[model samples]
Target chain A: MIEAEGIVHRYPGFSLSVSRLAVEPGEVLAVVGPSGAGKSTLLRLLGGLEAPQRGRVHRRGPAVYLDQTPYLLERSVLENAAFGLRLKGWPAQEARRRALGWLERVGLSGFADRPARALSGGERVRLALARALAVEPAALLLDEPTANLDPANVARIEALIRAERAAGRAVVLVTHNLFQARRLADRAVFLLEGRVVEAGPAPGFFQRPADPRTRAFLSGEMVW
Target chain B: MNEVLEITLRSLAVSSAATLIAAVFGLPLGLWLGARGAGRLARSLLYAGMGLPPVVVGLFFYFLFSRNGPLGGLGLLYTLPAVAVAESVLAFPLIAGFTMAGAASRAEGVRRLVKSLGGTETQAFLTLLAESRRVVVAALAAGFGAVISEVGAVTIVGGDIRHATRVLTTAVVLETRKGELERAAVLGLLLLGVTLVVSGLLVVFGEREAA
Candidate 1:
């Protein structure tokens, strides 16, 4: 479980203020917004990557945040995948075993010994996802996990996320792809200028957005 | 010929020891300052230290280790250890400052990534250091290069005692003063050759690891 209330983060000329947000286990909440809409900031705050100036983030257990451009260690693919496990104090052999399992799950088994920097874009994302999943966090906050990928990789990643939700982990996905949000989100929130514009059950949010701005955004007319 | 060889060997040993000592303390200090963004004042001081005059460093150490000065009881003055200590002092800022610059540029992303993985503060720092190993190596090279070619600090502290404290740089100075210009030039070339070989080896090693 993850929750934030009265959150406010500020930079030089912009501020993000979200009154309240929560995600329950076994649920996926998709945050949809235009560029500069603070979706990534919201994920960072939820994941404990950044502290909000005026709000508290409460997590029931560990949370992992995957950045839009994931930062992979300069190590072998297996080492990268096993990093979080090693941090959690797992024995090296056990961590490697578990990481290997994740690698196979993500279809990266053949590339385990390869240096992480040698991987392609899609492979890098898969490796990152595998690394995050290997840690088995209670909450996964993902920022644009599939910004640029082929349909097959997207399907694979979406399936992995669905599996996490099925296993009773809370997921907060930030995406610009409305179709992806509609497909995967149990509930959805529309944000604009760092404010929640509309939020509802995913089906209703897509079919009958209550706010005109949400409607404009859904129709691709809101460009910013 | 044997005397010249001994002097060259002593020079290498003193400078290598100095570089090692400087790196031992300097790398950690640089990593910390880089990871946690030093203040402007601290950064300014570090930059100034990097360019400190070797003669001034020599004078400072000479005073500290001289009779009636603080730490004089150790009897380190006019010894090889005294020369090594002086060189270490001269080299510390070069190692630390360059390492700081390198780490500062790359630490933030590594820190955030490590934190998101539920790693502790120490883990984050270690990971940052590992990721910036090349930077650390370059800093070590800079430190070694600075100390190996230095004559002022070693001369002041060691007194360049023949067959005892004389090193390549001081030997060159002594020979030149005695009008043995050919011998001085040979010693100078030997110093340059050592510097180039060590630097080249470090670069090659770094590249091999990268590959």
Candidate 2:
């Protein structure tokens, strides 16, 4: 389980305020909003990449945060995937073996020896996913996982997240695409101007958003 | 011819020795300066080192290591070791300064991301060094080149003692003055060939990596 309460982080002319949020094991929670709505910032707070000014996040299992910009290390693809595991004190041989397995899961097994910087954008996104999932974290947090990827890559990433959920891992995803929310989100949080204006089942919220702001967001009338 | 070959080998040894020592001292300094932006003092020092005249460095070492100087009691003056010492100091700034610039130009975000992944501090630093591998190579090459081509410092501190401190660069100058033009030409050609081969290899390595 991942729990965030009373989270408030200040930024220039903007703020991220999540009064209460939780993700149970095996459930997927997607935060959807327009650009600059602090969707990515919310995920960053949960993943421990950015600290909240006045709240605490309690994560039940190991947490790996993939930032909006993928930071692939300047190492072999395999080494890059195995990095976090090694940091967690796993032996090099075991970490690398598991990383290789995850690479295969992401359809990048054949290119394990390639330098990571040589990978294309889609390949990089997949590789990032493999690295994140290799740790077997109880929850997964993704920031704009498919934003820069093409349709094919987008489909593959969505499939990966779905698989992780199916395997009984919790997922917290941040995205602007309503189609993604409708397709994969078990529950959705509709954020408007740094506040969670609506939170409920994805079907009900997408079908009937509680807030006028959320309705405007869904209609493209409230694009930031 | 045999004598000249012997001197050339001796000189190459001097230059290589100088370069190796400089790398030992300079690589770490370069990595630090690169990882952290230089402060006012460090920035000035780096710029000065980049343009440091070999003669000045050589002259400074000579005075310090010579008789009546601070290190005079050690009697290292006029020895090959002292020449190597002077040359190493001459190259230290170049190797370290260029390396720092290389390390700093990349994103600080890489550093932040590495830390967030829970990597050890050592792993983080090694990661940064790996990213700047090419820049570090260039710094090392620059250091080696400067020491090999130098004349005044080695000539003054080394005292041009025949067959003892006669490295290639100083030897060429000495031989030319004594009307041994053929010997000097051969030595100069050899030095030119070495620099060309080294620089050519670096350029090729850089180009291939870039592509």
Candidate 3:
């Protein structure tokens, strides 16, 4: 489980505040907001990637945060996927075997020897996912994993997130896509102007939001 | 032809020695400075060092090794070691600065990724070096080129001693001074050939890494 209380993160031109947030094992929580609404910042805070100025975040263990853009080490795909395990002092043979299995799961078994940077956009995203999931972290923080990906790739990644949830990992996802929230999230937090305006089950939040701002955002009437 | 071979071998030995020493001293410093995050002033100082005139560096070493200079007791002046010391001094900054820039360019992203993957600081640093090996190799190539083709410092400190300290560049200068134009041209060709071979190998290695 991961929990953030009174979290406030400040940047040069933007500040994001989350009064409270929590994700339990085997549950998926989606943070939905417009651009500049601080969805990513909130995820970063919960993931322990950044410290909050005015609050605390509690996590059972390290959270693996995946950014929108994939960051692959300049190594072969197999090595890149196995990097997390290697960092934790896992044996090279075991790490490679598990990494290769993950690669196969991600449908890149044939390209395990290829340089990671040479991967296409969708393949890179899958590689990033494989790399993250291979670590079996306590929590997973994803920021727009489907952004810019084709429909098929988007569906594929969504299925992987579901798999992660089924594996009893807490998943905190930030996305602009409402349909994805309906599909993957057990609960949703609606944020506007860096503040949470609504929080409830996915069906209730999307179908019957309490805040007018949430309604405006859900209706696509909010200009930004 | 045998004399030419001897000179060529000596030149190769001196320059390669300089390059190896500089890399040993420079790569870690560069990686540390890059990983710790250098400020603008530090960066400017490194860049200045990179651009420092080689002749000036050579002259400084010359005085340092001269009989009356502080380090003169070793009697290393006008020797091959003297040339190597001067050349290494000239190459150090280029290697260090390029490595620093390369590491800094991707430090933020790579470090974050490594940290997310549960890598320790040391692991992250080693991974950063591995990722930036191409840039580091380019730095080495630049350093080697600067030293192997240089004449001023090596000539000033090595004294261009025949059959002892006469590297290709200094030999070319001596042959030119003696109006041995053909000999000078041949030495110049040998210098260019060495540079080409070294650079070609680095390029091929870099391509292999990329592939």
**Which structure among the candidates has the greatest DockQ?**
3
The predicted structure with the larger DockQ, 2 or 3, is 3
Q: Rate the local accuracy (lDDT) of all candidates.
A: 0.91, 0.84, 0.88
Candidate 1 lDDT over A86-117, as tens digits, reads: 98999999999999999999999999999998
For the second chain, the TM-scores of the candidates in order are 0.94, 0.88, 0.94
Off by over 4 Å in 3: B203-211
Q: With candidate 2 superimposed using the best TM-score fit, by how many Å does residue B209's alpha carbon deviate from the native? A: 14
List the candidate 1 regions with Cα displacement exceeding 4 Å: A150-152, B68-73, B177-189, B196-211
lDDT of 3 by residue, A25-95 (tens): 99999999898888888887777667799999999987898878868988899998998998899998999
- DockQ of every candidate structure: 0.55, 0.34, 0.58
TM values, all candidates: 0.91, 0.86, 0.95
Residue range A10-36, candidate 2, lDDT tens digits: 999998888999998888898988778
Question: lDDT score, residue A203, model 2?
Answer: 88
Model 2: number of clashes? Answer: 0
Off by over 4 Å in 2: A8-17, A34-41, A89-91, A190-198, B39-41, B105-113, B196-211
Q: Which digits, one per residue and each the tens of the lDDT, describe model 2 over residues B128-158?
A: 7777778877887798789888998998899
Flag the better candidate by TM-score, 1 or 2: 1
Model 2, residue A208: C-alpha shift (Å):
2.6
Model 3: which docking level applies? medium
Residue B24 of model 2, lDDT score: 88
**Residue-wise lDDT of candidate 3 within B1-211, one digit each (tens)?**
5998999889889999999899998899888788889889888988999888888988899899999999999999999988898899888999999999899887877877887776777888888888888998899899999999999899899989998898999999999999999999999999999998988887788657652
lDDT accuracy of residue A192 in candidate 3: 78
